[model samples]
Target: MINRISAVFLFLFFTLNASFAQQVLTFKGELAPIGDRVEILTDSNSTMSLRSALSSKEFKRSSGSQFPNLGTTPYSYWIRFTLKNESNSKAMGIQLTQSMMDYVDFYQVQGDSVTRTNFTGHRRPFNNRFVKHQTYIYQVPIIKGESQTIYLKVKSGKQLTLPIYVGSIEEVVENAMIIDLLFGIYLGIIMVMLLYNLFIYFSIRDITYLYYVSYLGIVMLTQASMQGYIFRFILPAYPEIADMFIYISTSLIGIAAIEFSKHFLSSKQYTPLLHRISYIFWALYGIQISLAIAGFHNFSYTMMLALAMVSAVYVLYMAVVIMLKGFRPAKFFLIAWTGFIFCVIIYVLKDFDLIFHYNNITNFTLLIGSAFEAIMLSFALADKINILKVEKEQSQLETLKALQENERIIKEQNVVLEARVIERTSELHEANEELNSTLENLKQTQSQLVESEKMASLGQLTAGIAHEINNPINFVTSNINPLKRDIDILLAALDEIEIVGLSDSTISAKQLRIKEYKEELDFDYLKVEINQLVKGINEGASRTAEIVKGLRVFSRLDEDDLKKADINQCLDSTMIIANNQLNNNIKVIMEYGELPLVECYAGKLNQVFLNIIINGIHAIHTKFGSTSGGELKIATYADEENVFINIYDNGIGMGPETQKKIFEPFFTTKDVGEGTGLGMSIAYNTIKKHKGQISVMSSPGEGSQFSLQIPIHNNQSLSHLN
Candidate 1:
């Protein structure tokens, strides 16, 4: 379909050339005076009398006032010279002369416009004489000087008189045809692009595409109209349509430019103020459109000025903003718009006749601007896509890194947890073994205690029996002593009776009496001895009872469970238990302060205190070499919420490295058999159970201070204490 349309346009263009060719004529002849009228004699011997030709009805002559007043008759005439081959070549070699040269004016018509051929000013002919004959040649060509006749018209006005002649018209229709063909091709490409972009706009509903389509349409139409194609073709039937197309195309171009800028620069994003200015230009474009519709040509030109000025300012502003914003596409846009602005300035200059050349500035501006605009917009689209791709890639990379980091952390935690599990298992096994050993030792001690109790009961029974036996033996001995004394007394009494001489019969009666008295006295003395022996046995039994009471008080075996026990009492008990560890070489300094009863496992606390004190003594003993005296300070104190026990030793302190590992299980500085390495570890655990904290501060060559703060009550109380 397009090919067919192209063929038709080509044919019409050639046909117009043919018509322009046929209308031109060329004239070459001689002017001579024959009697009262001048005669034009051609090379072919054809003579045309000037007066007769002027008298013909086909010729219009001016009145005497219009003719030049010379000293001779002023006669002027013109004729159309039809030429052969007028369409194919430029007319050449024809001439004209003045029979009387005072005043003459010759005008030739070309394409509906006329131009004067007469010389003006001092270059006019010097003599007003009619020579016998004057041969002249014309610069315009005749049509092969064959089939066509030349049209010659001569006119004399003012003070000039002459026999004017003309050559044939030079045909330019071929060149016009070539120019038209080129313009057609250019316009066709632009139209196709416009329509294609319009289709894209419709399909995609993108305003940018729509803007470009409108821009192309307007620019193409404006170029075509400005080049006079509309007058030659589409508007031929309506002559006014030629002028109207110019205005309309101008206004449309303005509207298109504004719309294109708004979209192409993305003015709304970076320069909202310029975007609003674009809207103002858009409103002015509406006015331009209205003026074009009204066929106001001057108003249209004024609109062009306004459009140029405003658009130039706006484009410059947009370029600056784009540059400041670092928009790469604006570089191309700036160059293109600057070129268009220069072209518009040139066009304005030419329109007012300030310049002489044919000004096709609009065509050049639109061509270059559109080309650059298309390229830049393509770059912009590509840039946008690239940015999105980069962002996506970065996002993916970050996500991958996060996932890897999470996995690494999880792996590390798993390793740490695994190690912790192994350590805890080992610790549990060690604790179990210790518990079993302690249980076995407790059983053995219980057995020993039972055996000791049995022995004690036997000893008590034996002592009681021994005491009873001793009491009877003592009683017999006492009785013997008393009898000896009484025997002495009786001998003395017999001596007295003998002196008085009442001998044998009296002695027999006295013997019976003395036997009775001896019996009574013996009984009384035995009772007194028994009482004394019983008193000695009672005193010995009382001493044994006191010893048993002291044993019971010291053991405290009945109160073994956890209880609110005085921390001071626990400290004292622990001190007593650890006395062997603390020899006289280490002075025990007790700074016992007022303390409330603490709820704790008293036995465990005693064990913890014993371990700590024993450790302190060891530290002191190691420092002083078991000989040099050292001081072990022990302190107990209580506040509203917690009881504190602090044991400090003036010993060679440990370094940080040793201190850090001090509480680790199986870490000890003592000899293998002397230290189990469980003391501090067990102390830490027991303190934890009691909801307490322990911390140490020490330096080498300086004493160590170990502080233990346990809650006075339960865990809640400790928390409140903190």
Candidate 2:
């Protein structure tokens, strides 16, 4: 680097390029920026020495570009500058910002030859550098009030953006330390985001967070590689690894970013076409990595940057689509990605030299953008947590409302049935006294008993419905309190963060305090617990929704109307309602076949299935004492015009005598109050009403199998059944 050039220009230029005045830098202070105060001569074959460059007389100063950046040039660049020091300090050095330059040759010119020569570059081992710095630095022997001409040659297999600085030992150390401090703060933000999100990811087992964390990691690695820290600290001995790190990381970063967007925005769910398109960009990034591996550095870097811009735009567009479709989380995602894309746009522009001034601000634009994006994306993830909590609450409320409405309906129906039962009993008693005949009174009582059997079936149905709905509601209610508590903790943390962020105090001063607060709060533990609570609530709400759906199918109130219905569905709905009675014992297996819709009373058929299932369950209990080793199988098949159902249970069976009596009214194997003695009888009657056939087969100690055949085309009149 040229610390201070004297008033006289050091290198002669081509006549056409010699329009500018003499270029010289005289150092009066400790440190100075030699960023653009030097002239460069490009040698196509990299064969220029100090004496030859001095004789070439073709060096030209860049007029507009701040940092002399020639992107990925394999040739050589000869920079000539005159430095004069007027200060007392003589321990002056030249610093080259680009760490990946393959070789750097510094030649101190005295008369026509080099007086002092130093060699250092990326190709040299860390221990072989003139100075033990991450970047190239050469100690120049310059006395006070003396001017010297310095010639430096640079060549690399990477993008060449050279920002040179010249300063004394004290000044350079001070500058480096300040830069380190700024980087320290940036690293802190990244670490915080990684640890916090990583905890949540493990707790909830959400793949979106995995992608998000991976993206964070890749960005950090890529930025570190570009900043030379990866070489300085991570892989100092292995220059090859550090040289390839940036290319690999750049490809992986795009992949991670695309995956994170695809899931977080639910792009497949909202914009499937666009989601498919993301893969193209991902494959393109892969190709870029391949090119880099194949040693096409310049082409690959250009392709990588182009693809990055295109993919960033695609992701932003996807987020917008999802946001417009009412995905709440996409709002923050959009804002975050937009800021990052804006920065990327500028970085790409500067790298291509479309933006004239290529300084540190443009060079590290991606880093700044990434830091902002990471923080905002964390907010988005947190917002999703709140959304889930609210959705769970809303779901529970709706379920409760539905439960209340169903209870009211059931109660009203019960009241009507009770009145009918009372009136029938009164009329039967009056008839017994009026007729004074045993046969007549017995017949009336038998009719009332059948009606009572229906009421008992209704009671079992209601009980089953209540039991099925209870457990999931219990799950939901149990989590509400814990969920609220965890959410409050997160909100408090966020509030504290906001307060601290808005404060005017320096970050480093409060850094230790922040660390202490994190330990005390245990953000990791809280994030995990909160994710678990939300998941539990979601599962509960999902179960409740399923119960409601089954109930709707099972309790079709329009029993008198003939509607086309799938028998398999009717069986499933019955199973859902009868789930309570099954407990953990009696394992039920259902094999349902494709069946045409049958025009019949769906409610009546649901009742028939329920009665049969309940009876089978009771038989299983009677046989095995409900200690769990019983199986009940229900299968359905269909023929040309009929659908058949076969329900079998491995339980204590009945003989021919009991089988004949099973379908008769007022006959049951259960004790007095245990059953109404009309379950099978009613099932038989309901099948008869649908012009269907019912039969049963059993042995004394084996099991019972009941078969029913119903016509797929039900053309019979049902007025008699009503």
Candidate 3:
């Protein structure tokens, strides 16, 4: 009975163990090619594991196409498969277990679709459905096996049948978060920079800033969309736009570079021609954009490449211009453009797949170039501001200096004007004093001239009266001489008659007595006495008449009347009138030549001659006094143009200093009371009135010569004489 009980317990235990094993069975397999079938059969298994012949001793069971008999809840399994390229080209496919596929989906990342596929508990027909999100479970049969790569994406949620099966899930999540965060930061930085530059452009109205902002915006959009961020969220409907963004970003970058170069380096200073070329590139870029919008992306891309090349050439030209111009920004621009060029080359190489890495280096280089460009552009802007400030200050300083100089000049002019005013005032005062003195002297000279004229007129009248009295006295004297003679004869006859008186013896005796008385009475002595008296009276009368003539000539009565007169005759008359004063003290020499009868005021000219002769006589008298004698020479001659009278004196000659002032009014060497000082002055005035000039030549102790030059009458009659 105890043996039977132990057998029952062993059966129950075996049954229970089988149920547990069936409930938790696991399978392992390998995806291998055997003839025409791809099988997953395990090489070894236990009661708790699924039955499979997929693994071998030579190859470990890395993955399988199917896993049957795997339990539900609390059981976990993973599968791996190696797909090979059965054709010459690469094959792309996916492998997953049916249970895991129920909650998972398949997505083709290489095409322009965002479709999803689900894998469920059962295998579905592989119909190559293009629109459906279906898992591709089929393998690509290999002609000559070449390894390919794909992912078996497993979706794990709360309803997942096994513990989450994933490789480095945390790492993937962290990497995705890092990429998102980095992209966000990059976008934020780009947005901030773009907005900041836009604000700057608005504030400054600089087109360069606008270009820079646009370039950065395009760069951010290209990077964001290129990484599928924009496709994932923002505009999933237009996946092709990302490609256009790439080209646009590139073109914008080139344009920005050109504009920045122009702004920073002052393109006008050097590469004006190249700047025009850059503008052409910009126009080409516009054409490229047009083409791109027209859906000619390839042509647009080609044109963009050409534009980029042109931009590079322009950059190089600008670099050369900057180097020649010696701008400091050239170095920075050159380095930045070169870096951009390298970046573009790398991007091109990356597109060709000749390079294994993405164009991260290109991006890095572009960033570096942008940084340099920004720094140089900022420096250039600052330099421009500083230069403008300096110019403004310099202009102001120059203006101030000019004002100061003008003020200084005005001040100097004012000082000079003041000095001139003072000088002019002083001269005016001196002129006024001289005028007053001259006025006083003129008054005194006028008084003296009037007195002299009065005295001369009185002398003329006195001489005329004396001449009339002399005529009467001479007549009386002549008559008295004859009467006395007759009286003497009568008295002698009476005496003879008395003596013969008393007789008729008479007449004969009386006549004889008268004759005797006439003989004896010294009638000759009586006659001599009477004649002496008469001769004396006659001499006195003749002297008086001569003085009257001199007075008349000196007075120049009727001098205004114009008449034809002989110059020699006038001179002779003057000499005759002056003879008395010049008789014994001075000798007169007349060298008279033949002259015309000039039309002139004869009386005035005669007066002029009289004055000059008298002056000559006085000069000689003053020279020799009464003790010595001097000669006064007078000459008259006529030339073709003039009738000249020369009055020369061998007397005390005047010095040059005295001769120069000799004709000046009131200027005389004579004592104050001795001369009226008008003789030469009157002569000079009279000669001037007659349109004649009187010139004097004199030297101290050598006498003086006066030449009176007068115009000769053309119609005058000349008498030729030696």
Judging by lDDT against the true structure, name the best candidate. Answer: 2
Off by over 4 Å in 3: 1-510, 524-543, 553-560, 714-722
The models' CA-based lDDT, in order, is 0.56, 0.81, 0.55
lDDT of 2 by residue, 107-131 (tens): 7764433566666666555666776
Q: Model 3, range 1-722, lDDT digits (tens) per residue? A: 32443333232223222222111111112222211112122222221221111111222232331222222222223322333344333322233212212223232211121123333321222223222222124322223344321222232211121111111223323434554675576666667667777887788786767666766666666555444455445543443554455556667777776776676667876777776767777777888887767766545655665566567766767886786777765665566566556655554433333352232244244344444444444444445546657888999999999999999999989989999999999999999999999999997877678458436634533554554456646665776767677567757667766767766766887677667776886767767776776766667667666656655655557554556777887786666555556646677788999998777677666666766676677678878888656988888888887898889998788887998998886677877665666767767776777777999998888788888987765344322100
User: Among these predicted structures, which one has the highest TM-score?
Assistant: 2
Stretches off by above 4 angstroms in model 1 are 1-171, 188-206, 230-242, 354-722
Candidate 1's residue-wise lDDT over 1-722, tens digit each? 33443332232223233234333332233222111122222211223342333233343222222111121112444433333433344443333333212122332333322221332111133221121111222444334435432334332211223323332322122323444566676676676666766776676576777777767777776776655455444654443455566666777777777778767778889888878877777677778768657645445555666676668767777877876898765766676676666666554543333342222333244444544454455445445445657888999999999999999999989989999999999999999999999999997875565345334423433454345445545545555555565556557656654554455557667666656655745646655655655565455555445444323322345655556777787776555445545555788789999988888767566656766676777788888986867989988888899988889998888889888987776578888656656667767777887788988888988878889999987844322110
Model 2, runs deviating above 4 Å: 1-22, 49-51, 111-116, 415-722
TM-score per model over all chains: 0.34, 0.55, 0.34
